[model samples]
Target chain A: MPKVGMEPIRRAALVQATIDEIGASGSLDVTVSQIAKRAGMSSALAHHYFGGKEQIFLAAMRHTLAVYAAEVRGALGMADSPRTRIEAIVRAGFGTTNFRREVVSAWLNFYVLAQTSGEAGRLLNVYQRRLHANLLYNLRPLVGDKAEEVAQRIGGLIDGIYLREALGTKTTNGSKATAMVLAALDLELGQGK
Target chain B: MPKVGMEPIRRAALVQATIDEIGASGSLDVTVSQIAKRAGMSSALAHHYFGGKEQIFLAAMRHTLAVYAAEVRGALGMADSPRTRIEAIVRAGFGTTNFRREVVSAWLNFYVLAQTSGEAGRLLNVYQRRLHANLLYNLRPLVGDKAEEVAQRIGGLIDGIYLREALGTKTTNGSKATAMVLAALDLELGQGK
Candidate 1:
């Protein structure tokens, strides 16, 4: 439940804080008290804004999907031709941007939780499948007859980079991971890293 | 502390039982009394096998890693060409072997526990980093000049699929993923379901 007057701003702020909390570390269960303290508001106010932690988590995760969808759309703007657009779309997953750190952190944390045994994991899996379907639909023309396969491949590639960065155990950086996949596609990308 | 009759086989048996217990879902901590019950032996027999659950867990995790490492090596043997070997090696992480299932479950559980802020998490992180680094070293020859970049790509791909499959949500089988990747590599693969 939201106060009718402050709904948009309050909701945005809650989701933003959620992303910041998860991004600063990993997405653990952030308590009502912790979120309230961080927001400079009462726990009751936080609850009123987002209902509860689950609602807040879902909002933050969905907010990230929206952000990336917009970026992918914008990146699609970088080139008029389909081949170049596909390259831009692939690069979008790896390029340094303001959202890069937070996105990668959120991305890794998302998949980590997705591996667990429960509702949270199932929700994440559903979201990813739907998201990839949309991406495949978007890239269908660019990939010609093999759009579905290409979409999964690209999703896996983006997922692979997010996994590496989140695991923080891999020896190479985001750019390196991006370059190899691009090279494999023979998409004529310059050495990014 | 082991009893007088403690033997390596007995110790291995105890660890194997612990692995199944953990795999099937249960609290890992046990009195030697419980291990004896699980093993259908006298309490003294459990005492003879090993010191306790901690030892059992350590050995289980080590066994998991060793098994995965061996599977990886075997998968790499199935192909003659560099590209073929790389594809096979990637499949190793998503293989159909019994070892793949057990090792994935063990590693996934360990990884989740590792995310918590504690000694267990740190230990898992350090050990996995070493293993991932060693895995990358094996890909050096196939990658040639772009070894580091290629390693990052391939390593991330392998772990990404493992993470998804371990969850048993996104990927129920590896064939589709394998085909998608093989297609991306320009290798002709059988149709995916």
Candidate 2:
């Protein structure tokens, strides 16, 4: 029973170690031995949980995404207004300020990795679609009849913004920038700017 | 020197051959020899014009982006209203049906590569920034006091759309889905849908 209780913690520790390595070294290609050394666990333990590098890598990616999805949902649910909700989602997307820069960089790096592999690529796409779907679901009511087209435009701009910000442009802080994007959507739909 | 000419056609032909190779075999790492063979030129002749693999790749990318950028600018310019311009830009971003799937797929693959290395990465960011800046400039007359914020938001959505679309999910393309995103923005801004 005690050994069973240790399993999740050990796996979690492995994932955390992987995240750390990626953040520090700007890559996720560090070996299980590297992760095990960092986690202070025997390499056998790493193998026991993950079976291989692919499994461990999957765990790390899934863990990061799960946290992201939960935070994004929480952000959307936190505020009453759509604008505030969108801002919250954007802020949540940035994760925490202390770990923000490295976390974002790591996420982007993993995303590119996900894009390369067929199986992992499919998984990442599903997760992202759901994330955007949730945003669209929250946004549908306010946009009325033109909601679909409006969403297309908004979605485009959001993608455009992340690429810019991720590349060191830093157009504005998360909250303010979200507000501006929302406002433009209104203007684009023939609503007030 | 005058026979083959310093004309756009030679470069265009070389770019076409490179594009075909890139699409058939994933990755932009096509060799100068490979490209020269496809372009019906001797290896030395190819080197004479393009120098090396990186240079050839950059030239091909530039050629591709130039085509895309022109289409986008034309689409936007045709519209008198900012709202209409937004619509045109979105359509242009998705690209046309002719090479839509191939081109978009290639672009997404390149995007991942650009995240890692080479002139392609640099060009990717530069072209995006230039486009965003241009959008901001055009958006100024429409947004007025809130111009900057609107620009950033617009930029984000634009980037977001491509990321979502490239993931090849119906969610990024659906009406009810996209509307929700726009609605969320509208409600956040306290504007009517």
Candidate 3:
């Protein structure tokens, strides 16, 4: 029999391993065996846990999203104003843990996966809706009626920066990306006034 | 001889077929036979022309980019001012031909392909550079020293809008997408003044 209460630990290791593997490959063209090896476990065990490669990838993304949500919640908790709250949300997006090469690669691949996978599509919709809601919620106080439009632009900018960074065409680090979005925020606020 | 002046025509059909195939499936997980059959040609002949699926996809993107460049050039020909030139560029991106659901899907897949394919990466880099150059050239008179930064933000915004639209999270059509980018352009210009 297996050790009791070990499922969560093994699952966490597999999720991290999946992200590392996808990052190294820069695409979804990875194998279950490779991920299993990276996690220091057997393929059979990995399959027993996650069912298949797709599930493993989905699980990794879930973990990544959860981490990102935690970061945003933590940052938002300390923000004193509506503008700062927006800033906190933008910074959380480009935070170190969320903006790593592997994490970004996973995001790009996930976007692609959402194209064909229904489950992925639903998950992505949830993320997009949550992001839009968060931006709109804070932006309401500042932009008032223009909050929806401004939120869409900010959300689009964040996603766009993430997409560009994943391509690695430019050496835009987290802080640089954060600054760019913040500048956009300033422009929106200025225009609204 | 097989036929006179048929090479270019055959290649065009194959490229269009590739785009349609990728768009229909929404990923690169497609087969050469499927593309060939859709193009109304045999897989053997398709291989004779493009060598493989990857080459066929590269050709499809080349055609897409060429069409986009032509659209931009055509629009710029009638543009009366620098701001109008910027508007022309933004409008061309979200124009009907370039912003079709199939074409956007192809673009998203191509971005994913760039991660693992050197040629795709180079092609994407060329597209990115040309976009930056075009934006900077026109933005110079308007923003002066801040042209590069403004251009970068505009480029990122364009990309972000495309990414969001591809996911189909919101019902943002081409005109709507174009309007969003133009608004960002306006904000940047206003802030630079």
**DockQ top scorer:** 3
The residue ranges of model 3 lying beyond 4 angstroms of the native Cα positions read A1-4, A191-193, B1-5, B191-193
Local accuracy of candidate 3 as per-residue lDDT tens digits, A161-193: 999999997879999999988988888888421
Candidate 2 lDDT by residue in tens digits, B29-122: 4577787788877778777777776677777778778887888778877898765675566566655531344455556556645644556768
lDDT of each: 0.59, 0.63, 0.89
Tell me the alpha-carbon RMSD of every candidate: 6.3, 6.0, 2.0
The TM-score between candidate 1 and the true structure equals 0.68
- DockQ of every predicted complex: 0.27, 0.29, 0.66
Report the number of clashing residue pairs per model.
Answer: 0, 26, 0
**Docking quality tier of model 2:** acceptable
Scanning candidate 1 chain B in windows of ten residues, the lowest lDDT window is B184-193
lDDT of 1 by residue, B78-182 (tens): 777666676765576566663244455656555544444454456666555654565455555644555565555555555566655655654456666565455
The TM-score between candidate 2 and the true structure equals: 0.68
TM-score winner between 1 and 3, please give it.
3
CAPRI band of model 3?
Answer: medium
As a whole number from 0 to 100, the lDDT of residue B75 in candidate 1 is: 75
C-alpha DockQ for predicted model 2: 0.29
Instruction: State the lDDT at B168 in candidate 3.
Output: 80
